[model samples]
Target: MSDRKSNDEAESLLAGLMRFTGQVAGGTLEIARHTATMTAMFGEGWVRQMLLHSMEPERLEAMADAGHFLRDARETAGLSLKELADSLGLSDKSVLEEVERGDKIMPLELVLRSASLLARHDPVPFLIKFLRTYNPQLEQVLEQWGVMALPRQYERERRFVNLYRQHDALRGLSDDEHDRFIQYIDGAAQLVLDVMQKEKAANSPPTRVPKRPSPARKRTPRKRS
Candidate 1:
């Protein structure tokens, strides 16, 4: 009788675990579909936010100076507090004022939108500075990844890859699952970088090649002769 009861309990637990795993798999698939449907810029922005959200809660909370970073980015973008608030669709500018003063955590959605809007000002660098300030663990990981020697252009991609690895580890993905998802993330990051490069090139002013001084009028020597 005891053996039968033990077997029944073990089977029930195993079934519950299977159900939970199925739910997680289904949810992941749905999220992947939705994210894949987003335009490149928006998709990359979403991925960046996902990385930000993966930070340890305690570290995130201690990020009191995040407001200062936001304020600096806003100033660099040449936006007034009210202007930024309006752009972010916030009805009250004072809320943003509070955020700028380091009194509040920036909402996740706001972080995503703000990062996109502040692209010209290099929001990724701002985020990296924030990480360096508040999260030593992430800095150590970045150091391990040889972040310093890499050119500035690839910083966003490297940071995203690192964060995606952290996200996978947190999710307890199997080795095979991690390998597959990481490849996808790498492709997405490359796509984003390509788009950004193209856009930058398109918006750049045409290079004006200096006209050679028409061989300085060879006839002048003939006239002297």
Candidate 2:
């Protein structure tokens, strides 16, 4: 009876030890899995932040007051407040005054119209100054994209005059011929512009992130005879 009791006690102890070991192993595995999951999530977030930072345009910490620029442009154009208001089709100078004082937020359409009017007075200088004041990043991006070199007012006028002269000269040609000629000219111009843009982009600095390498697989040991 004593031997049986000792044997029973030993068996119970062994079973408890086994259960405790199993629980420890399972808990360790769960903790390891949780750690790995957390690490992966952290890595993903870090990568996303880096990507966004790299891709986002450089922005001003504080934007210039739109009204200030409008007021300056108006003054530079040598227009009186009343005249500016009248040109904009306002009944009175109250809106202009508010804008000039930076007390009221101007609408995008009004801002654009103001810029256009200023551009008529001084195209290149006004555009450069205005864009730099409002959004320097846009100016930089446009320059990088190779679209900043727009035709001047005189150049556009000359182009239209030349087009008219050419049309008159080609009046003797058939209508179909004239249409084909115009299409060819347009296609050729577009092709040239496309090529120039492609070259510009190619020359620009690359902004892509390097890819991460995959983990190597563990090799299984060969069975020995």
Candidate 3:
């Protein structure tokens, strides 16, 4: 009778263990299924945000002064202080300097000139940001274009490509002319790539030196029979 009672207790314990194992397995499967479903519903960026939500959020820089923005835009377009001043038809650099130093607000004509000169450098967004403070309607226009979320560099590149395609010179070109145009475009692309590579190399973090592997022991070759 005692032997039978021991066997019964062992069986009951084994059954409970099996049930607990099943519950754990089921829960793991359910979690995996839910994760897959979520991945399908939302993109990887959404999933990444969820995983990183507990970390410190990114801090956005305060909007730059309008004058500073213009200066930077001019520099990005490879224009010097004097060149920009001359382009604006100023006799001396004092006005440009004063505007850049935030000592004076830019006049409408100067602002328009700056925009035209900096067109290839994506000056619109910065201009919009600066103008919106005084003109509320600009905010609505920016919202319509979804420019707030788009990156400035990407927008600039997109605009450049679009303008290149729509240029009057590109329209109605013969095959030979088209080929020459493509070659010119290729040269321009190379120049842009070189500049970008130089900038990236300058700004990139220094690479860590890799550990040297241990030298292998010299082995004598065996003669084949």
- Ten-residue segment with the worst summed lDDT in candidate 2? 55-64
Question: Please, what is the whole-model Cα lDDT of each candidate in the order they appear?
Answer: 0.62, 0.59, 0.63
Per residue, candidate 1 scores C-alpha lDDT tens digits across 102-218 of 444455456667777875445555555444323335444555556644435555564554464454354787789878887997899799999999999999999999987766645
What is the TM-score of candidate 3?
0.35
TM-scores, in order shown? Answer: 0.36, 0.30, 0.35
Which consecutive 10 residues in model 1 have the weakest lDDT in total?
129-138
Between candidates 1 and 2, the TM-score winner: 1
Please state the error at residue 33 of candidate 3 in Å.
67
Model 1 misplacement above 4 A:
1-62, 129-136, 148-225
lDDT of 3: 0.63
Model 3, 81-174: lDDT tens per residue?
8988888788888877866764444555667677777764555665564553233344454565466665456557655765765577677899
How do the candidates rank by lDDT, highest first? Answer: 3, 1, 2
- Residue 144 of model 3, lDDT score: 55
Lowest summed lDDT window (length 10), candidate 3 = 55-64
Please give the distance, in angstroms, between residue 39's alpha carbon in candidate 1 and its true position after superposition.
37
For TM-score, the strongest prediction is 1
